[model samples]
Target: MAAPAELQAALDLLRGLRERHGIDVVTTAQAARSAPAQAAALALRHLLPADLIWHIEGHEVLARLASGDVLVLGLDPSPRVNGRAVREGRLRRATIDEGSARAVFELAAALWSNPKFLPEIEPIGTLMPPPSDALAVPRGMEFVSAMARSDRPLPKVVDEVPTPGWLAPGLLGLAGPRRQAFERTVWNALRFLLLHELGHVCLGHLELGARKQRYRMIEELRIRDGAAPPKAGGLTDEARRALEIEADGFAAARLFGEAHERDASTGLQAGMLSATASALLGAALVPIIFHAMQVFSETPEPLSTHPPLWFRADAMMRAAMPGAGTGALLDAPLRHWAANDALQRPLAAAGHTHPLLGQWLGPVIDGGLDGPARRVLAEARFARDGLLRGRLRVQQQVVPSRGP
Candidate 1:
């Protein structure tokens, strides 16, 4: 079926570009029947390639372009986005090939696919020492802070703590099947991300916004459709933010087929713990890590054109497992943990008085110095202690009218 008006716009651009540059969205079934041309276009929908143009014998599709009407572009390896589309009068050409977008997504996939290395510090989720006992932290928060930095900036955990060497070959590291598991995670993520760009282009986000390119981190940046600002080609950051949530819905639906919106219990409830499960959880945790990196690197808010970390992460998980609810809160397990006064006593006896420290204590099957994936499961708080939660809170206070 022809796409919606938004997606149909891409075809219009394709026709226009063909009129100007004699290029089309080639496919094996389409005009570009040559193996090389077909491969390049197929690659756009699947894997990322080093270069857009691949030399193929017995192919006249590209050879015919030797007349300088078309450019066979390659992927842009850098994941950091620095472009925005602007509308203009007349049939002017873009300074950069929109096809290069595959490169940026490929780069993001490579980063997210990387294994969790040893010697990483996990992010702090609502955990800290009281002002009265800041100097005398009985829990290892002080130690973690000291090890992470001599002059820690209040929050000890940045995005994640160092992956335990012990768990490297076992639970966390990309060893054996874990590597494959993580790769799958990256693949699913790429589908969501790349399709999102398609969503933007087809949705006509580029033509609606200012013709100037704007850079944003891959974590939050997304191609989206939104209400155009009042001024012609005037892109409002708020409008862009709203667009992200909409695009996320579009991406999630296509990535994960329609499932129940809310499942009261998922496999996690059945004590399903495996490298694959961890890999999936790790995939869910990726945006959170990148968001923390953005904070650490001090990326400005102007680049933030998407929903907050909590919203995005929650959306992904909820889509993946209906009713997962942000992946921050463990509904059933959390309830049991909260009610167990005995659990709190043991945590207190162990000098883990901070309520956040509850994340560290659990039974053998549940947790034992929870690994990154397990810790994610154990974490039952957002809005107050989450890295994004803190940011979201401040944002809500500042812009009291923002949507959840």
Candidate 2:
């Protein structure tokens, strides 16, 4: 491990940059607060890169720091923050080894210098201290005053203690075969979130708002869309939202590159896998009558944010083994027979077929269908039902939405 003095020097340098760059950071320390919160803070600090500094307060650390620039250290939580202290046992015992710590610190440092690391969203100037600060801290208000010193005047990070009753879901519960699937989902989701945030910073949407009214409108829209609100001293919701979408697109393009359109194709392939697996599993499991119910229950509902599951399963099956002629038209009986077997078998009877589903749903057995296959299936069904097909040509009445 690097010497404490050396670490301190690195921290000093980062903080200096934050000050010079106009970035704001918040601090939290375990030695400054109750035992529980302190431990959690300590664990959090270690897990983070050394480029990030640990701010020592009384018993806890809850301040934010710039993820890429600025390290916030030293503060007394009792002065302004509210909440009971955390317990030591509840905190995970994992420590950042010297090597990993150095690696992370270096990563952060490199990111700081990289043009890619620049903020994608505009910073919203705001700050809030811990609840304890109001109770006994005369200088607790420094949280806001400190913002004045920043050159960028952006809230880079916010540090606050976790609530007393807070319980982070255990990773163990997500273990086993299901765990891998869950991790895939979580990984993609987290990556998406980070990308979106980066997009905001990179796109320069922060400067779009000029007043509280405009900012508030942006914030409301973001909330309605199910995004996490900006931290106490972070960027505005509008900036974050716009940036998040940008990041998602960036990540999608970067990860898939020239295969950007191929991702859709890939997703379709996964859907085929899901469909094949579902059909096989369904057939293996129970009575033929039960097959219809299982298929119906597992069927993807229309108008969902996600694509149809059956369609995805079918697409994946096609991708896995390509070059087959139109099986639907060639062997109608065979398709039904095959679907019967698929419907009987449980997805668990199969292995990691989630990836065959594509993107978020690719990791789990329970998810939406493939888009292409869903359309094809719908068309096939439509063709089979001539009456319904003819009805499609009739005019339909438009239903207006009720005012909210």
Candidate 3:
């Protein structure tokens, strides 16, 4: 595939995805709600060839059109928000669901609250503490009663900045470097994801034999009712896996860019390396842990448009760093997520559904929601890091890392 013709085709696809995706783009307020994802797109945008004629949709998923245009789906902020404030000397409450409200408020905090939308951080009122009663309500109450007036008024939809444009930093529950780490992870993972799609476009697979079979296969998948069997149009699982692997390779290569140069006399290299590691694993977490997809099997993937998440993550590391081994890149991320207890947070938040969801999700951070990815990343670290030539190490037993 690296032969010149294939190479040029791939180059064209990459250029087409990046350049043609960003032409004459005008960003609207709603489109900017996905600041992290958009920032990732823009970062990729900055790296592309200047002559390319792509214009990014301020909102959309990654897709290439037959017309040579592209789309990157972004976050759309909720048109509505909750909380209360006294307006013209009256207390007003919003009718809202608590969970959804919390998630949106958290997102708003993670995003627009950061001061570094210029480049780096998340915030909410923690930058300044408002009384707990201001945000709190009687348990399970749909409408919140207003608290005594203070310098900072209660959060309301009207208070949200219109057209936050991703650059507007927001806050979460975090403080200090912990906050920075979360923001960096948010930005980096989304960037790596965009890179993977760019990889597909770059490899020219979208226009090539066998790989181009994705179009027909997509139509097959779209056949929701039991009309006809889903078809691969002669695209085997192996071939599809190869295409996905190639795309992941594209993402990994750029995701780890120029870390050594930053190593200089200063200590910036370490931070850069950590950020890159976050990107690689963060990309994997999306489909595996977050989206609740079926876990990858020990076998080659079945017919699908892409490889499984674990496979993609492992393939990506192996392709990019080769002999350096993938374990180095995975250990810290795996450990960090576990130590922070992040993976379980959602299941916990699910209330009554937590038990069934946990079983479905693979409760052991060592293996389940989708176990194979976590296991593979862990094993790669153990074997390559030389902790064990035999058996796998679970989250409970830490393999002293040579660390990702």
Best by TM-score: 3
RMSD of 1: 15.5
TM-score each candidate: 0.38, 0.25, 0.42
Which candidate number has the best lDDT?
3
The 0-to-1 C-alpha lDDT of every candidate, in the order given, reads 0.32, 0.27, 0.34
Rank list by lDDT: 3, 1, 2
CA error at residue 72 for candidate 3, angstroms: 9.3
Report the error of model 2 at residue 31, Å. Answer: 16
Error of 1 at 102 (Å): 13
lDDT (Cα) of model 3: 0.34
Name the lDDT of candidate 1. 0.32
The window of 10 residues in a row where model 1 has the poorest summed lDDT is 56-65
Q: Rank the candidates by TM-score, best first.
A: 3, 1, 2
Model 3: CA > 4 A from native: 1-27, 34-41, 47-170, 210-234, 259-273, 289-291, 294-305, 316-404
Better by TM-score, candidate 3 or 1 = 3
